[model samples]
Target: MYKASCSCRMLERKGILCRHIIWIYSSNGVKTIPDEYVVNRWCKDALRSKSFNCNGDPAEEIDIIDAKQISMSKMWSEVHQTVGIPMGRSKEVVDSFSSLIREFKEKLAPLGSQMSKEQEMVALIGCSTTQEVTIFPPKKSKNKGSGKRLLSSKTKAIALAMKPKRMYQNDN
Candidate 1:
């Protein structure tokens, strides 16, 4: 009988059993990993748990606005879990979702068509109107040639001063 032992770092790091421990259990005819080794966050229904407060306890007696927001969030989460994830996995599901979205947008178009003439005009004006401030090009300096000559003279002087004197070449 081969003895198997682990440093238990897997339990600390991953909240699960190490392969060494699993091997030992399998060799001893264990069928399933124990519940204590499983982390709730890794489970399928992890998000189905009750909402927790900042203090880490279950939240209670929220305001009406907060309750509505929470309900909307939960609905969105459920829809994403059920629809979005599956759609990503299957091309047929993705096509169906796309068609459903198109139909929904078409149905909603009439409801969104009640914009006032003033609102339409404002939107059109916003899109079409460009601010017409005259931007004068930068003024050309009157001393441009003098400035270039001064810069070139300074640079040439600096370069000549920095040039290393050739060794063994004495000034005659």
Candidate 2:
């Protein structure tokens, strides 16, 4: 077993090995990364199940209402993967895909707009609250070189008095 550590601590922070660790592994003639180092979420088998918990464990109980949501999510993922393969190959393909998306958007617009403003906001932000949410404006900031430089009235008058006038001469 080869033991190595990086000063960057990328593996500890992001669960991804740093270049130094990778170089050490390469120099040691390691054929594959050890299973312990590989993060489960980045693996192909991560989503083998229909849905999983945050701890990388298969959910023991699935909600009845969420069943349809999970199925729809799976179907959409498959559809996206299938349609994304031949994208950008030709102009005809791009045009056809754009028109298809537009057609679907037109058809779905009415159904989407059926929801009230509050319902739409909840759907967009994924949060619903019984209490009123008052979002105050951001604090005024004085960033360097943002607004015009303020000058005193005396300075302004001095500048105006010192201004150069253009003298035009007539050629007779």
The residue-by-residue lDDT of candidate 1 on 1-172, one tens digit each, is 3334478777777766788898888888978777766688888867664677443667765436677678979988986775655544678877887788789879889888677876796664444333585687889778646543445888889999999987896788
Where's the lowest-lDDT run of ten residues in candidate 1? 122-131
* Total backbone collisions for each predicted model: 0, 0
Off by over 4 Å in 1: 1-5, 42-107, 113-172
Q: Write the per-residue lDDT of candidate 2 for residues 1-172, one digit (tens) a residue.
A: 6677899999999989899999999999997888789789988767555656444566675437677788989989998996796676898887888789789889878886688888997875556655755697899987888678899999999999999988999999
lDDT of 1: 0.71
For each candidate in the order shown, give its overall lDDT on alpha carbons: 0.71, 0.81
Best by lDDT: 2
Can you give the lDDT of residue 160 in candidate 2? 95
TM-score of each: 0.30, 0.39
User: Which residue pairs in model 2 clash with each other?
Assistant: none
**Worst 10-residue stretch by lDDT in candidate 2?**
47-56
> Model 2 compared with the native: what TM-score?
0.39
Q: What value does the lDDT take at residue 92 in candidate 2?
A: 84
lDDT of candidate 2? 0.81
